[model samples]
Structure formats: structure tokens, C-alpha cells
Target: MSIITNIEDLRQRSKKILPRMLFDYVDGGSYDEQTLRRNETDFDALQLRQRVMVDTSGKRLGRSVLGQSYALPVGIAPTGMAGLYYPEGEVVALAAAEKWNIPYTLSTLSICSLEQLRGSTDYPFWFQLYIMKDRAFTESLIERAAAAHCSALVLTVDLPISGQRHRDIKNGLSVPLRFTGGGLFDMMLRHGWWRRQMFAKSKSFGNLAGMASAENSKLMGLAQWCASQYDPSLSWDDVAWIRKLWKGKLIAKGVLNAEDARHAIDHGCDAVIVSNHGGRQLDGARSTISSLRSVATAVNRQAPVLLDGGIRSGQDIIRALALGADLCMVGRPYLYALSAAGPAGLDTLFTILKNELEVCMALMGIRDLSEVDETCLENPRYFSREY
Candidate 1:
């Protein structure tokens, strides 16, 4: 634990530090979790073609997406209730992303608000949104993001209905956090986390609770209100509506098919993120990396194609790029690190991934991310079009 070697090490540490319900929330996916397993396991099927003789001395990890250059071909994907993992978690993660020069996406349900993050650092971050039942509330959220000077708006088009995560039900990690005696014991065991939470700015959904409380509902009532407001009526029409309202880089963050990717681009999305909601939505759906191949082919460079899920290492990022992803977004990796060691863990996580990427690039004789392609893999057709 002292000398963490990789993301898995961070994962192990996080599992110990985080309470059972919290850890399962971050770790488990929907239904049987078949897609969840595939997200990580699918990477093993693709092998990187290592070349030794060429000069890799001028290597750079930098990759440009939608006119902005990233420190690496990675960004932190939006995760709800991120602050539950650590004290002021979203703020810490955003600051870390700023330091690393990669974008940190603020979730609609994040514990820290956009203003908090903007105040913490002036750097522009991405905001992920889910169209709510209340159009006014959703618009207000959009207005807030614009006020915060968010660089991009990631519209997550999946989850019209919440997936049944068995672990959460079993653990009683409900909307208002109903806890059984055992669940209370489990949470209480992580004393440091809750102790720090007492001093933290907001313990509930930062972006959401304030939205309602300022109007009529109190905290718990607001949580209930927000919970019931996830729009099952969210549709393609809503996409166009949001597109007209906001004039920033719009990224569709939950696309899993070529047609969906094309539709997002056609609907004014600046880019399409090939994701399966980290297998948190549909259980039997294809892994994001597995689907990236065909989606990238369909996109054909019209706009950036980003991959989310199944990326555990720098090598996985390489695989994603070679398959056609412009960049990658990580959720669980950073979450694990943050839960394990707070702010320093974020630095360590980025450091480990950067070094791993650098070493992988060096071994592959790749000068930069632009030099990466399908040819870098031994058998490039590991990703299927069958989906």
C-alpha cells in the first residue's frame, strides 16, 4: 500500500477505506454486471504491437480534442455524489485535473456545486447534464453552467429509467440514504470519511439540493424532488432544445452505437462519447471499447469520438486511440484514488497513469498520440461490429 504500483493498487486501497455501500456504488454495475466485467476484460483481447528500433525520444502524450490540447489523452468522467468518496471530493478532483491539465467533468448530482469548483479554481471544466422533468430546473442548471464558464456540456442521453443496481438495493443506499443497522455499522466504520464530511461544505447533492431548497423544498424534500425528476420523457427533441439554448462544445456522453453517434453529431453535438454508462445502465450491452471500433468508423473524424469505461491503464488508452477514440474519460480510477487518499491520491493516480502511458509509448516507438493508429495492434479486429 505504501508504494502503489497501479490503478488496481489504488482500487484495493479504496475498497478498504470506503464503506461497503459506497464502494459497491462505485464498483457495481446494473443487473448481472456482464457488461461491467466486459469493460475491463475486453481490453485483454487486444494486444499492443511493440516495436523497439525506432526513435521515441520526441514522444508527447498531448492530444488535441475540439481545439483544446490535453496534458494527456484522458479526462475525468462525471460521477454523481463524488464527494461521498472523499471530503469536498469534486473540488479535490477538479483541482487535480486542473493541475494535470485534463478536464474534470462535474456531474449534475455532484456533491460540490459548479460555483464551488469555479471558486476553487478559475479553470474551465466540463458539466454533464441529465434533462429533468422540470424544464425550468434543467434550464437553470444550464444557466449555472454557462455562468461558471464551463468549457463543454456533456449530455448523458442514457438512463431515462434508473437501472436496478442490486448491490445498492441490498445495501439500502437509497435516494434518502436509508440504512439498516448493519449498513450503519459499515458506514460508521469509515469514521474519517464521515468526520471530514461534517466539516465539508455540502453533504447532499450540491448541484441539486440548492436548486429546490432556494425555492420551496428543504434538503430531504429536495432530494426526493430531484430523485423523482429524472425525465423519462427525455427525448431527441430535448437534445435540439438544449443545443439551441447552449452555445458551447456539446458532447453526447452515453452513445453506444454508430447511429446514435451520428444522431448526436447531427443534433449539434460537438463530439460523441462511446459509453455504456460504465455498464451501469444496460447489463448485456457491448463494452464502450468494444463499441468504439464501429462508432469511430461511422464518425470517421467528423468530430471527436471519446471512449468511457474499461480504461484501466495507459495501455488501454492506447488501445482506445488506435481503435479511433480521440481521447478517453475515466470515472472509477480517479474515484478509487480519491477515496483511498484524498487529494494526494489524485496526484499519485495521474502520475502512475502518465508514467504507464509514457513507457507504453516508448516501447511502441510512438513519438506522440497522433502517431498512434490501428496498425499499432497485433490483431486490430479484436473489437467487433456485430453489436
Candidate 2:
């Protein structure tokens, strides 16, 4: 009920409002979480070059990615079960993104279906695909996204198997929450949160409700079905197959190395997101920021390279752009903001980021995104080192 001014404030508020299981699902990372911790720490390691007494007027944050212009370079990275954080959360985030004129990516596991999202907003949003063991269902998802008029297909190449998050297992996290006595007690303590979610539009996974088997529609059943759906056999050949099926711009979302990035370009992707699934997929893999320069160098502009993971502020966004990222995507920060307030929370979060970015750009003597490059970093030598 207080003013949520920053991402940390939103995160703390989200912790207070959301149930432990739901909060952990968004906040926790896999295994030892070395990669997760490194993701943010590495950004701190890169310092921005500060310039003074320059004409900072007429500054613009707008940039185009995959041929679509945005009010800002940042996009809402897809986070599944967003509705669990707040009522109809994904829809709220999409609406906020549309109003802000930036992209909002809908996860295949999102609580809101593509159709529901399409019905809610006239703006075209990107769709993220998670290939499943059920090839037919995977194809069907692509078809559905196309029918919904998705602007791009973000094929998440990682996550052949869900990483083991300690918190999720300990908390007994499941959809349509299987409440233990402790969990119920926790929910009871947050009566306001309970009432809002209880009254909110829908709790079921909208996209998978019809496709999921009856047995898979229950609490733990959904988890089991989701785990079983991940196909370990997924390969580059599958990406080619998907390319043949999808006519829109294709973006491979989990590239961490140059070889993989090159594969994405060779397979005809329009962009490659240098990401590690926010360190949720691989625990000890190098941070996305650390890998950005090498992957960007390899791709050599064959396709635009975007970075996702540990992007918490506009300063971080600028650092990514300096390190060779064409754009950036944020996941947890926006979710925390949405959970803290709602649509208004998102509006505030975007405003804060935009303002911070503008201020940073002005300080760097840069007036536009095109002016941002490796030269904007205080220490470009760190980025020049071989990965």
C-alpha cells in the first residue's frame, strides 16, 4: 500500500504478498545457483564511462529489434505462471508493455492463452516456444501463435529438462496449489492476497487447459505433465523444422556460446538472445553478460544479438548495449513490480528504468541508442578478453 519506487522495493513487497511457493518459483534459481548469482554480479563488474558537459537534449531511448521499433530497447522477458503472482498477471504485463510501446513475450506455459492476449490488446506481441515431447502439441502451439498473430517466434533452445530448484522441491510447488497446513496458514496470514487471487479472472493455465490430458489438469498432474513434455532429443534439426513451420521472424532465445549462436544464424533465425534462461536452466554456466561479447563477435551481425538475464536497471541495459547486445529483456524485475502493485506498478517500473537509462545515456554523452557501443564502457579491455 506504500509507494513502490524501485525493483528491490517491488521484490520485497512481492515477497510479502505472494505465497512462499509462488515467490520462490520466481525468485529461486537451479542447483548451487552459481550462474544466477554471477549473472547480476558480472554486470556490476562492468563500469560505464561517464562524460560531462555535453548537449544531452533530444535524447531518444527508441530502438528496433527484428524490424519492430520500440519506445525503449527493453522487452518483458516471458515468465511462466505470472498470474500466480497477481490476478491475470500476464495480461496486465502485456497491456502495460503495449501502453509503453515495447514487446511483451508470452510464454508457452503462461496462464493466459495467446487468444486471450490477442483479444485483450491490438498490439502484436512475441510468443516464446518450449518444444515438447509431444511433437503434435508443439506444432499445434506454433499454429496457435501464428493464428493469434504473434510478431515473432522465440524458440527457447535450453530447457530440454527442467533444472532442479531446491526451493521448489522443498516448498512442494505446484499449480492450482496443493496447500499444506503451513501453506494454508501462510495464505491465511495474507488475506488480502487471497481475496484478490480468488476474485481474479482465471487461475488455470489458459493455453494448456484444453490440450493437457484430463489426468494432467490437476495440481501435481500439471507439474508431472510439464516435466514429461520436455524432449531430451531436441536438436538443431528441430529448429530447422520449426523454421519451416513458422513464417514470422524466428529468434533463438538460449544462446550462450558463439557456436550455438552461429547455428541459430545458419538455421535462419533473425536474432539470438544470449541467455542462460536467467540461470534457471544451467547453474554454473557463464553469465549472459560475460558471454555476450564473444557471441556477438561470432554472429558478426548476421543476426541481431539480444541479452537476457540479470538486467535490473537502465544502467545494466546500457552496459549490455556497450557489450554488443542490440537490446535487452527483463524477467524477474517486472514480475516483482507487477506483484507489488499491478498495472500501475509496471508503469512505475518502466518509468524508473526509462528515466535511469536516459540519465545514464546523457552522462555518457550519448543521445541515442545508435551512439551506444563498446566505447561507452569505462573498461572495454575486460570485454575484449577471450571467453
Candidate 3:
């Protein structure tokens, strides 16, 4: 096996180890994936101003979000059915995050239940919600999160309707995985992944236990479930309704504009995660980084502003900090690590990123994350224009 030193290494390994359907679910974005490509490219366009001759002995990569202290600012972003990456991947992911003193967000569509995960980790984590058309079910989920001791409620506002991820349809990705002749061949090639998946105790969406009991539930699938559940009428007014039910910290995810960012604050969101759903929705939309500065400016420290999408490395995390993001939520990178390797892979990924981030900061003469502002960039004034 090759010595893994970076996220790309893990990604390549994951691609080889997992089946095509599962790998594509983690890797491929929606439609043409223009915004997906742009997410990374936009971050690459921004350059850091390397500084020299400064004290660098006491740099610590730490931050507090929602009254919780993290050893690093990067937290696991919610991914649907994360357990498919490895056997009980979400459980392992949470355990790893707890070990590192970071956060793990459980997706509404997770294969592990909040109650189950609550027992696995010592510390509390965040929960991501997609307001269902069934308000009763939505309220039940909120109640369940509270019961699970989830610290914050991450209200995902972007996905009013499901985006057409071309890969999913092409791969015929579904739960219980109907295998084509080629798929069977592919599975034979990747027996290790198949074996792990077969042994997974609660693979049928643990969060949605008893929700799909029919014999053909696997063919019915989560996407179809999402289509049926997601309320298209989800508006800012719904935030008030949710706010009434959830007293914990509320973070509005998927805000791409300043108006919406500020409006999230207006609707009593504790934080705003600037995302385009990792470019899995709105394929032609602006990259999260491109829109991040404006959203950050709009929130203006009234609430924490975070960025998600295309954060493949610690250098990318540094780019986000310079662009005015308070914290960054990582999706694909963690999944890559968890899927490629096991618990150790996740820990190694975190270590590599930590080293990269600190080195990047130290080279730029930054001793703390607090010092990481717009000044750290070559074009600090690039975001000076009105939104």
C-alpha cells in the first residue's frame, strides 16, 4: 500500500476500494458539476501572503463554535448514508471526531439514529435537518435531537427540492443496491467493501427505522423518500416555526447571498453556513468561496459565518479563514478518509490537515486562528465591494 500523506491519496484509495455506486455517491456532483469544479478552483485562485521573520513557537489551531471548543475549526459536514462508506462509518466518524475534540454533524438521512450515536460518543455533536412536509415528523426529529443531547440544530435551508445528481441515476444507486451484470462483476472485484456492507447491522437508514418496511423498500430508496418528504414551501417563515420548537443553536446552511445571510440572522439563526450543498445542487451556481466573503460581510460578526464545499485541504481551510469565514464544515474530505481507511485513516487525515494548516499559518507569520483575517491574503480588498 502507498504511504498516505494527503486527502487526495485517501480519495484515490477510497475510489478503488468502494463499489462504483457508493464511490460515485460520495464523489460525483449534480448535473454538469460546474459549481462543483468551481468550488475548488475558486479557492485555488486565492493566494496567501507569505510572511517572514516572525515568532512561530506558540501557534494553536483551536476555535469555539456554539459555545463548544474544538481542537480544530474543521468539523464533519452531514452526509446522507455515511455508514455506506465503511461498516457503521457514521459511528466511527463520530468516535474519531470526539477523540480529536472536533464536531460531527449527523445527517437527517444518516444510516445511524441520533439515539444510537448519542451513546457512541462522550461529547455532544450537531444535527442537520431537512424540514419535511410532514411537520409532525419534523417536530419528532427535533424532539429526538434534543433527547440525544445534540448541542446545535443545523437547519439546512438549501434543499427545498432534490437536485438531479446524474451519477446516482446513471449508477442506479439505491439502498440494498440492485446489482446489474456489470455491478455484480464490480462487486466481485470489490468483495471487501461488499462484505463490510453485508455485516452492517443497521444499514437501512437507522434514523428512519420502521419508515420503510415494505419488501421493496430498498428499490424505493432514500432519494424517493426525500422527494416525498422535503417541503418545497420551505420559506423564511418556517425558521420562526422551527425556532419556536428548537431552543438550541440554529445554523442556517446553504446561504449563497448576503441578503439571505443577513436574513438568516434576522430569522434568529445563530450561525450561517455558506454552502451550495457541495455543488450537488445548483450545478451552475457560484462557488461557496466566491459567495463567502459577501455572506460573511453581511453577517458581520452578528453571527458566526461558516463555509462548506471544496475544502479538500488545510490550505483550503486557510483560504476560507482569509475570506472571512469563522469556521469551515468539511464533507467529502472526511468521507474520503473514513471510506479509504478506517478510524485510523480519519485520525491520520486530521493530523495531515492540522500540520498543513499550522504550517501555512506559520509561514504567513500567524500564531493563532484569530490573526487569520483578510490581511493574510494577497488581495485583501478583493471583497471590499458592496454585496
Candidate 4:
């Protein structure tokens, strides 16, 4: 195999190794995918000022978020079905984050249970919770996180209803994958991936299946189970309620509008992520980068504003920082790494990004991430006027 040089290469490799259904699940976006394409393109439009003859030595990537130190400002966004990417990919991903001294957030919908990761690593990683119609189940999950010693609770408010990804529907992407005769043939074609995944251990949605006997439960598939549980009527009052329950740093994910940012702060949220659910929900929603400036301004620095969507590289992370995000979360890139190369692959991807980020910062004449701001961006002549 050729050496993996960058994230793009890893993505290509992942595509080759993973089955079509699973690869599309990780890489594809909602219907039309316009927002998905824009997420990456918008970052390219921004230009960084290059400084020559600047002192090159002694730069640090270390930073803090929510009163905790991170090796860098990047965190892994929670992705469901990570195990399908690789056998026990969540464990490998979190373990990688622990080694790097950054936070790894476990998705509420992840296949791994809180118990599975509780003693898996020494670091107390953060936990993400999606408010469900089952209030008892949601509360119990929060209790589980607390019991597992999670340091923060990230409440994802965007996906009240799952977005319609046409690819997923066409590919029959569901939990406990229904392999029709054709599907079995497809699985047989990707024998290497199937062998590693199937032989390592039994696969189940560890977190959900733990709550009840999945075999006897009414929810037959992942889509059905997720649809029945997500609380569509969630309100700010619920945020306040969760605030009292968590007693730790609270981050509200999926905020793209300024009004929501202000309300998140009012409800005592410590941070508001400027995200469009990675373009997975609301296909036509404004790019998280486009909406970020207003969202950041509305919050008025009262709360840390982070972003996640369309970030594919270290340069993208820098672009978000320049635009006023306190930090950035990467979803699909790491998933690709985990799927393509396992723990070793993730390590390679992180190494390439860290090197590239440092070089970009040095060339831009910035000593640290704190030095990045609006000065590096050009306001388009057509967009200078207020909307």
C-alpha cells in the first residue's frame, strides 16, 4: 500500500476498504448536498496573510476550552455507528484523543455504552446527549455519564427529526443491518473489512441494547428507534432543566441562528456550537461558517462559540478560528481515518494535520491560535452591506 500523505488520501483509502453503504453513510450528506459542498468551499475563499522573516522557533498548539487544557483546540464530534467504521472504532478514537490530551465526545447514539468506555481510558472525556421523548431514558443516560465521570455534557438540539439522506434510504442503511441476498454478496465482496469486524466481537448498539432486551423491544431498526425517541418538542426550558441535572459544563450544539445563541447563553449554556449538523440536517441551511460571525456577535463573547461542519483539514480549523470560533470539531475526517487505518490510521491523520497546522500558522506569522482573527479575512465587496 502507498503511504497516506493527507486526509484526502485517507478518505480515498476508506472508500476502497468500507462497503458502499457504510462509506456513504459516513461521507454523504442530505438531499442535494449543496450545504455539504459549501461547507468546505467557503473555507477556501478565505485568505491568510503571509509574514516573512518572523521568528520561527517556540510556538505552542496547546489551548484550553471550558476551563480544561487541550493539546489543540480540535475535538472529535460524536458519530453514531462508529463501530461499523471499524470494530470498536469509538474505543480507538477516544483512546487516540486521550493520548493526544484532547477531548473525545461520545455520541448519545453511539454503539458503545457509557460503561464500555468508563474504564477504557484514564481521561474523563466529555459526553453528548440528545434529548429524547423518553424523559426517563434521557435522565438515566445523564446519570450514567455522571457515574462514568464525564466532565461535560453537550446537549445536541438540532436533530429533533433525522434528516433525509437519500443515499441512506437507497442503500438500506439501518441498524442490525438487513443483509438481503444482494447485501450478503456485497458483504462477501469486502471480505477483509467484514472479517475484522465480524470476528473481533459481537456487534450491538451497546448503549441502547443495555437499557432493554433489544430482541424483544418494539423498535426494530436504528431509524425507527431514533425516530420514536428524539424529542421534537424540546424547548429552552428543557435546557435549564438539564443544566440543573448535569452540574458541569453545558454546551448547546446545532445553533446556527443568532437568537438561539443568545437564548443558549440565557439558559446558562457555557458554549454554543455554530453547526448545521454537519449538513446532515437541513440541507439548505446556511453554512456554519457563514452564520458564525452573527452568532459570535450575538453571544458577545459571553459564551464560547465553537463550530463544526465541512471541516476537512487543519487549514479548515485555522479558518474557523480566524472567523471567531473558539474551537472546531471534526466529524467525518476522523471517521474516515478510523475506518481506513484503525488506530494507526487515526494517528497518521492527526500527525499530518498537526504538522500542516503548525506550518500554516508559522507562514501566516502567527505564534499561536490566539493571534488568528478577522484581520486575516477579506470582506467581499458585494457582501459588505448589511442584509
Candidate 5:
């Protein structure tokens, strides 16, 4: 608990607790991992403006996204193997989101089924759908989400083909973890991990296991399923069809280009998240933060704009908001927090972020999140001189 000071601290603990394969699977990126590094560093390039003599007491972080008010504009992005991190990782994350009064998006690949989540949690959470070749199955998933009373449908459009992650391939990362001799030996060294798994018997993928009974008793690897099922030919027409099936808010994720952003708007997407699947897809793709302003301006701010990828601190959140991202999502940071110290760690993360944001707002001389707008950022003079 004491070691959990920042996201990096959680990462270190998770690295020690989880097996090498699992840690690499979550932390590593595709190919060169250039985009991954950029996702973090690009946010650093954006500088914030500080003003003096403005009151910042009692500043509120509450926000509304797609007609729903949130205690914080931040939401947990969908991660596939959350269950692997700690038993029922999705449950832990959703529970945390519920406690924080923010939206929690369940991944299409989640181990915990929508019903399981809905039954356990009171409020409706958002659902992220990955279009598959089987239109019937995809439609069925959307229908199930609807049945679960999901408030929003997030359709990920970029991963037509899975990115080549060297670490996953080398480590043989799968859902029902294939325990090799090395893996078992590693697990043995991690006495704490073994104790938790053996005693709690929480290694099961709660949501997905029952849905597919044949693989229920056995471990099901997410990468293998994704490789087999992710539809490569998915297009805008699919989005239109899914939108019709889902009556609630529809958001398009993996949007990087302005043209695609416009297309998302054309299909009536309530919002579009400018993400490269957290650098899990398109290895050298532009950072979501770098692409935010153009995409937001391209859509003419007509729809709510959300950004994800490389958001580690409150300053990064502020930078995104100042650059036109109405809301943002963080993936690994929350996942790390969950893996390191479970619910308490996550609570610590939320408190730390809230405090960091308050300090930033106060230092920037703003009393409200709404007031911390694009004007608070000083666009590079060299870049602006061309204008």
C-alpha cells in the first residue's frame, strides 16, 4: 500500500507480482513501440499557462459526457484481460468507477459477462464492441449489452488486423494461460500471486467462460479468440447498423484522421475517441493527444470529443482538455493500480488524480474545469508563426 505513490510505482509492483508473460502482455506494445512512447512524451510537449490572483477553492471536477453527468470526466477504457490481472479485474474496475460516479466501459473481450457486471453493479456501464466477421454474433453481443441496460455503445473501428506485438508472440500470452515449465517456476517464485489464485480460486474469466461452455472449464486465451474472430472487413455501414440496434449513445473509438472523424459524425456517432487503441494497434500511428485538436476542429466540435492513450497524470488530462478533448480515458494506469493493490490502490489513484487536478487548476488560476480551456495552453510560437 505504501509503495503505491504513482502509476509507475504500481507498474513496478505488478511487474514483480505477475508472471513475466502477463506483465509483458499488458505493458509491451507492437513492433517498434514508437507510438507507445510518443503517446506518453507527446503530452509532455504541451505546456500549460499559469495565472496569478485567481481563486481556485472548491473547484469541481464533475463533467457530463453524452447527456450523462459524471463525477469525473475520466472513465476507464475497455481492456481485454482485466480478469487476468486480478480475479474479476473488470468487476474491480467497474466497482471503482461506480464508487467514483464515473462511467466504466466493459470490453467486448471481457471475461466478466455483461449480465454478471449488471447484476453486481447498480448503475449502467458503457460497452465497447469489436466488430466481428459474424454479423449475427456481433449483433447478438450488442443486443446482450442492450439487455444489460448499457448506457453507451463504443465501437472500435481501427483493428481490422491485430498489431504484431513481439512480446505476446514470444511469451505465448493467452487467456487460459498455457503454463509452461518456466511459467510455473515463475509462478512459484511469486508466492503472493500463487496464494491469491489458489485460495481465492478466482482465475476464471467470469463473463466469457459460461458464454462459451466448451472453453469454460479450460482457460481461454483472448489473443487467440481475437485472432480468430476480429472482422477485418468492418466498415462504416456496420457502424450504421449497430447504431440502429443500439438506441443509446454511440461512440466511435480508434478515430485518428479528420476524414474518419467526419465519417463518424456522418454516421451520427454521439462522440468519437481519438485513440490508436492505446498504441496497441498501428505501431507508428500518431499519438491521440497530437491528433486531438485537428480532429476536434474537423468535426467542428459538433459532437462531444473524447481522447485516450498516454494519460498518466492530471497535467496530461488538463492538456487534453485544454486542447479540445471534452473527456478522456486512461487504460494501463488504472489497470496497474488494480493489479498492484486492488480496490484500495484504485481509490488512492482516484484521490491522487483529483488532488493533482485541483493543484493544477489552482496553479493555473482557474476555479472551474470549464474555465481551463484551450486558451490556457500556449501553442508553440514557432508552429503558430506559420499561421
Candidate 6:
């Protein structure tokens, strides 16, 4: 209703509009949420070096990641059940990314099917794959991504098994949403969200629709099916198998340490995303930004290193770039913006991030992304500290 100028504003608005379960699913992390809290706090710990008496003309934010050009050095990270944020949320976010000329990754668990998203726009979007217990199903998903003309395959390596998210358990969160009386009451209170989402285009998990039988499509049943599908036996061998199957650029997401980063490269990945699944898994693990410097050093520029987790603003993106990240991905911030005001909120969010990045660059006496490096940072000790 009032002026929504920042990501935090969008977050608050999303809290007000979304049901508690859906909101918690996006907002909360695993166990004690230590990693989740650290992700943002560590960014605050890093201060930028400001320079005044220099030319700040002809600033450029455009960047190329894994052979694709982007208007910004950021991409929309894959988020599951984005439709729960708003009706057809994935499609809306993809549309926004298309308008901005940035990549939008479709999650394997996304509500919109790959075909649906591909049909929505001519631009090629990346596809994120989760290796399930069923190898046949996993291979099928890879084949489907190729059929959909996905330019890249983001293999999420961290989630061999889902983390124990306390909020999700307490709220009884599920794909279709297990509605309790309290949950129903919460939804009733958010009348606008209810009206919009109830009549929304798709309610079931779009990608998994044909795979799941009608009985397994129910709220609790779908949760059970999903739980049973996650293969704890998933390993580097699977990544190798996927690489052999997929001809496009392969990005290994969820690389938090040097060993994993090296393994990602060894398995023929084009890029390694230094992430902890937004702290949704491994709650005690180090934040993505805190691990970026070390991972980047280990990789030694063998492959481009991308980062995701607690990136709320353009200044955060700059911090990641300074720490050795080639590109940054955002998840919750854009979801909150989309939930707050649909596609328009995403447009505003992008505008705010780009403006902030430009302003920060100018203050640092830097005009382009290439000019950003460790020199723009203030505390060297922070980067050296082991997480």
C-alpha cells in the first residue's frame, strides 16, 4: 500500500500476505538456523572502501556467466514451490528475469512445468536438477530439460536428503499445503492472497504432475513421496553420469568448500556455485560469502564461481564480487518482492538493486564489475578467518 523501496519492505509485505506455512517455508532454515543468520550478518561485517575524488563515468553492470550475457551480474536462483508465494510465481519471476535480460533457473520442484515456462518466453532459462532415488526418473528429468532447450543444468549437490527444518515441521508445510484450522484461519485473514491463489493457474507441482499418481498428489502423500525420492546414496559418480547425459553447460550448485569445488570441476562442471542451499541444509555450515574467498582460491579460476545466500541488495552483490565471486544469485529477496506486488514488485526490486550497485561502485571509484576486487574491501582479517 505504501512506498515499497527495499527488500526488507517486500519481506514484511510478504509476511502479511502469505499464509504462515508458506511464508515460513521460504523464510526459515534448518535446525538452529545459525548458518542462515550468519549468511546475512557476515555480509554486514565486510565494509567497503569509499573513494571520492575520482571519475565515476560510464558505469557498466553487464556481465557474462557460463557464456551467456546478462544485464546484471545476478541471476534468479531456483526456488521450489514458488507458486505458493503467489499464483504462478515461477512464471511471474521468469517474466521479470526476461524483461531484465537475466537468467531464471527453474527448480525441479517448481510449480510450473519446464514446458510451460519454455512456452511462456522465447528466452532460454536454466534448469536445476535434484537427483532422486529413482535413477530413471532423474535421467528422465535431464532428458526433459534438454527437450525444453535449457541452456544450462544446475546440479544441486547438497540436498541428498532434506534438512530438518523445524519451522516446516511445526507448521506442517507441504507442496499442496497441509491445512490445519489455524492454517485455514491464517489464509482467511489474508483474503487477497487467498482469492488470487485459489483461482491460480496451477496448484500441483507442475513438473511432477505426470510422475505422481493421483493418490500421491495429495498434501501429505506428496510430502511422503518427495521424502522417499531423495537418494542419500547420491555421489560424484551421479554427477559424472549427468555430465555424460547433458551436453549443455553444467553448473554444480551447493559447493561450500574447496574439496567440493574441486570435485565439481573434476566432474566436468563449467561453474561452481558456492552455496549452502540458502542455509536450508547444514545449519552449522559457513555462510556462502564467508566461504567464497576460500573456494575461489581453491578453484584457482579453473571455473567461474557463483554465489547465492543472504544476497539482499546490490551492495551484497558487490561484496561477493570483491570476495572473488564471478556472479551472484538471489533466491528469497526476489520471492519476497514477487509475493509483495507480483511482477511489478520484481521490477522495482531489480531497479533498487541496480541503482544501489551503481551508487556503491561510484563511491568506491569503480565504474565496472571488472574493477571490483579485494582492493575495494576494508577488513582483510575477515576474509582470512576460517569459518
Tens digits of per-residue lDDT for model 1, 1-387 = 459999999999998888798899999999999999999999989999999998988689998998898899999999988887887899999889889999789999888899899999888799999898878988999999999999999999997878888998788775435567998888788887667766776777777765666655554555556666777888788999999999999999899888888889888999999999999999998888889988998888999999999899999999999999999999999899999898889989889889999999999999888989999999889766544
lDDT of 4 at 281: 88
Write one digit per residue (lDDT tens) for candidate 3, span 254-289. 999999998899999999999999999888999998
Name the regions of candidate 1 deviating beyond 4 angstroms: 175-178, 210-223
Task: Give each prediction's root-mean-square deviation over alpha carbons.
Answer: 1.9, 1.6, 1.9, 2.0, 2.7, 1.6
Better of 1 and 5 by lDDT: 1
On the 0 to 100 scale, the lDDT of residue 189 in model 6 is: 94
lDDT of 5 by residue, 187-305 (tens): 78987766665644345444445434433334255445546667777888988898888899999999987899999999979999999988888888888888887787788878999
Q: What C-alpha root-mean-square deviation, in Å, does candidate 3 show against the real structure?
A: 1.9
Root mean square deviation (Cα) for candidate 6 = 1.6
TM-score of 1: 0.96
Q: What's the residue-level lDDT of 221 in candidate 5?
A: 55
Clashes of each: 0, 0, 0, 0, 5, 0
Return the lDDT, model 4, position 217: 68
Candidate lDDT values, in order: 0.88, 0.88, 0.87, 0.82, 0.82, 0.89
Give per-model TM-scores. 0.96, 0.97, 0.96, 0.95, 0.94, 0.97
The predicted structure with the larger TM-score, 5 or 6, is 6
Candidate 1 backbone clash number: 0
Clashing pairs in 1: none
Worst window of 10 by summed lDDT in candidate 2: 211-220
Please list the residue runs of candidate 3 whose C-alpha ends up more than 4 Å from where it truly belongs after superposition: 213-219, 383-386
Candidate 4 per-residue C-alpha lDDT over 1-387 given as tens digits, one digit per residue, 9 for 90 to 100: 248888889999998888888889888899999888888887777766778788867778877888888888788888888887888878888999988887788987777778888867767788889888878888988999999999889899898888889988888877866766666778778877997988645366766764434433665665577667777788999999999899889999999888899899999999999988878889887888787878887888798898998787778788788777988888888888998889988888788778888998888777888878887555422112212
lDDT of 6 by residue, 9-76 (tens): 88999999898988898999999999999999999999999999889899999998888889999999
TM-score, cand. 2: 0.97
lDDT for model 5 comes to 0.82
